[model samples]
Target: MALKLYNTLTRRKEEFRPVNPPQVKFYVCGPTVYDYIHLGNARVFIVFDVIRRYLQHRGYRVMLVQNYTDIDDKMIQRAAEQGFTVPELAERFIDAYEADVRALKVKPADIQPRATGHIPQIIALIGRLVEKRAAYPSGGDVYFDTAGYENYGALSHQKREELLAGARVDPGEKKRNPLDFVLWKQKKPGEPAWDSPWGAGRPGWHIECSAMAMHYLSETIDLHAGGADLIFPHHENEIAQSTAATGSPFARYWLHAGYLNIDDAKMSKSLGNVLTVRELVKEHHPLDLRFLILSAHYRSPLNFNSELVEASRSGRQRLQEMVDNLNRALPGAGAASAAAESRLQAALEQARFRFTEAMDDDFNTAGAVAVLFELGRDCNIYLKEGYPYQRGLLEKAIGFYREANKILDILEMENPGELEHDIREAIARREKARCRKDWTEADRIRDALLARGVILEDTPYGTRWKKKA
Candidate 1:
């Protein structure tokens, strides 16, 4: 069976197929880099990283491109407020964003193109749109002529009437229509300026992505993904700009991660309750966060709180303990039971098939996680009965776990590189401190673990550490 992906444009799970075989082009909207990445942004990054990782695991050479919106209104305004240069402000937050996501185990994309780096591409795209009469320059600002694009509202599935109802502004209020979005903004006084055909100004929010994606991944991408909040105005405008220039489908699949809500209200910077990845990991482990995310479908809203985080930590602890125990039990001393071996083989086949089947169904991480839990249950039973220690059987289980983990982007297998001597020493010191009931030293060691992307968990069995991401 073919892999399935839930496309936001169609609101349905469609069979996934690359435009070109064996090569997948993926573009995801990266951080704006005006501040540290919040947990909401982390959710999007981790979910899409899993998608790209899964594609690669399935034998596709996935060329992933994620863009940094380094020169948006937010960046400009923040730079001015901080009395810093635009590049300086962007550079600071960009590093913070990278460290934040890395701490969450989001693998870096093959290409992370920044909007500032692709100014020429943005200018060229805007120029083509103007030449085609799909965009117009008004009052020194350029906007896409939404009325000219027959499929302007197709991706967002909102009709002209629906858009106008929510727009509040007059349809005739802009360069062309109410739905018309900005492509280039005229520079304001004291703002960072860039030389463009339209004069010294900066790229608009929507144009950065369209330009950067094309610059890095080509005109059309195999998959274009972002948070569900971006479905309208953002991605809708991307389709408008890119397709207006190329006259081709912008992306084969549009994947969107569900939002993260706090106290049942959507988390946003405007809400003033926005929790950065740094903040969340300070209170909870990265893998615990991943476990919490996978507990529900990506298309479903994730309700986050400290209590829920504690629950996630406990759940992940139980699950990882099972994995560790299973690995330990695999290399047994006794001869294997034929029935045990056969049953284990059957269970592996069933779990593996179910895992792939779940991924094949719109990358249903929730379903895949359910299957993993079932595999864990079966392993518990298999453990009770001593097996012949079939190396192949043991490997299949580990491989199955690891492969499924790629789709959800959750599991953190300890890597030697990640576990340097300093980290090991910290862990040892942490264990000793805890045993000595030196609360201050234990907290100090815990902070050190956080620095290394390993979170310390104190269980009945003692201190167990897992990677932050």
Candidate 2:
């Protein structure tokens, strides 16, 4: 089946056809670079990472661009509170963001432009908007003329009255329409200033993305993605100014990941429930967090808690254990009967089909992951049957896992030597206890291993250990 993704712009699932086939221009809104990235932010990044990976896997050459907002109001305020220059603060947090996402195994974007680095592009875009009469200057600030853009609320799908109900002019502002948003902010005392036609000031929040995306990619890109929270004024403003300036669609397809809640409640500063990716990695494996995020549909709200994370960790370990068992059994196995090999091959083929079907339907990672577990279960049954394992069949099973891992990126095993040694020692002790008829000792060892996320299954071949999922 061809790939289909839910486009927020059209409010429906549409078959993905880039403006140029086999060359996708994907853009995702990156962090503000003022503070450590939290789990909510991590969800957006990981979701897009998987999308990019899947696109590549499907034979699309994707040039992904994710920008850094290095000079926003939040960055300026945070730099002052932390006693650092704005650039210093941006550098610090940008490094932190990269480190955190790398730990989660998210691939880096093809181009990561910073707002401060693209000042010329931003100024030139604003100049084009001014020339087109899409924006106007007031009190040394440049604000987009929402009235000039007839389809102001097209992206957000809100009526003008609905947008106007919530819009308001801030104190000391000179916008003709409350719905109009700033393109450039005039210089404030002691703040970072850049030379632009609209006096000496910095780019506003929305314009930075429009300028950077168009400069790096094109005026009309394939996909634009961010969290669902950005569907409002941020993305809405981006659509208006970008289309008005270029006289073309900003992005053909829009994707938004759902909100990530903390224990069934929204994460907020007043609640103090925000969890940073850096801190969570110290407590749990980074892959576990990535797995948890993908366990639910990308557009479905996912709840993060200790229970869910532990479950995800166990699930990830279970998949890894299947691969490890295949490795261990492959080295010491004879050829299997033709019937056995045929059965396993059929199962593998079915799994491949199902996985592709799921992923093609709007990148349904949850369904795709279910296919992995189902395949793992089939492999476990085949191993337990004690048939002479064929080298080709075992290798094929491992190959399927490797193919899935390329897109999911959740099956990486760390320190396999050390872990294997420990499991071997524990199993040996249990075998000795069983031989001596020390049932209590054997049971205790079994329970202890189970507690440590290992499961022992006594087969006719011998006592075998797999991870507890």
Candidate 3:
């Protein structure tokens, strides 16, 4: 089945047809580098990373670009509060963002453009908008003329009157309409400044993305994605200014990942419940967090709590144990009957079909993950001691898991050699005790292994072990 992605622009799922076949220009909005990234931010990063991976898996060469907003009001304020320069603050948090996402196993973007690094591109785009009269200058600042953009509310699907109900002019702003957004802010004392036709100032928050995406990709890119929060003023402004300037669509498809909540509540500073990836990883495994995030549909709101994370940890360990069992059994596997091979092959094919079907339906990762669990269960059932093991068929199962991991990135692919020798010896001794009906000795060995964070499970095949989650 062809991949179908839900387009936020049209509020419907559509077949994914890139502007240029086999070459997808994908752009995701990155974080404002003023503080540590929270779980909500991590969700956007991970969700897009998987989407990019799946696109490549489907034979598209995706050039993914995620930009860093290094010079924004938040960065300036944070730098002042911390007694550091804006550049210093940006450097610190950009490093933090990278480290946090890397721990979650997200692949690095092909292009990580910083807004400050592309000042010229930003100025050039603003110049085009001014030339087209889509924007106007006021008090040494430049603002996009929202009134001039006929399709202002198209992307967000809000009527002009509905938007106006919540819009208000900020103090000291000079624009024709309340909805007019700043394109360039006049430089304030002690703030970072760049030279532009409007004067010495920095690019506004929304314009930075429009400038960087168009400059790095093209006038019209295949996809643009971010958190659902950005669907409004942020992404809406992008569409208005970009399309008005170029007379072309800004992005062919818009995808927004759902909001991530903390324990059924919105993450908020007032509530003091905001959980950063940096802090969360100190206690929970990063991969477990990734697993929990993927357990839900990408566009569905996800609730994060300790209980859910623990469940994900246990689930992840089950998959790892299945892989380990296959690896350990592969070395001593005997030939299988034709019937056995055929049965396993059919199961594997069914798993492949189901997994692809899930992913194709708007990247339903939760459904895809269910397919993984099903495959794991099938593997465990087939690995029973009474069943003959075919080395080639077992290897094929391992390959399927590795292939899935390329997209999900949830499993730890440790080889048999990586399993601790002492643990294996202990399991061996426990099995011997079991064979001799030495219940006390077996219990003692099991307790000892459990103390060391090694969990042993007695399967129909034999003894299987995995590290405690």
Number of clashing residue pairs in every model? 4, 0, 0
lDDT of 3 by residue, 117-222 (tens): 9999999999999989999999989999999888999989999889999997687668889999999999999999998898899999999899999988999999
C-alpha local distance difference test of each model: 0.81, 0.91, 0.92
Tell me which residue pairs clash in candidate 2. Answer: none
- Tens digits of per-residue lDDT, candidate 1, 107-145, equal 999888888888889999999999999999987888899
**TM-score for candidate 1, residues paired by index:** 0.85
The regions of model 2 sitting more than 4 angstroms off are: 335-342, 413-415, 418-458, 463-469
Which candidate wins on TM-score? 3
Off by over 4 Å in 1: 168-174, 269-271, 330-340, 387-392, 415-469
* Residue pair clashes in candidate 1: 104-469, 286-468, 336-387, 336-388
State, as a TM-score between 0 and 1, how close model 2 is to the true structure. Answer: 0.92
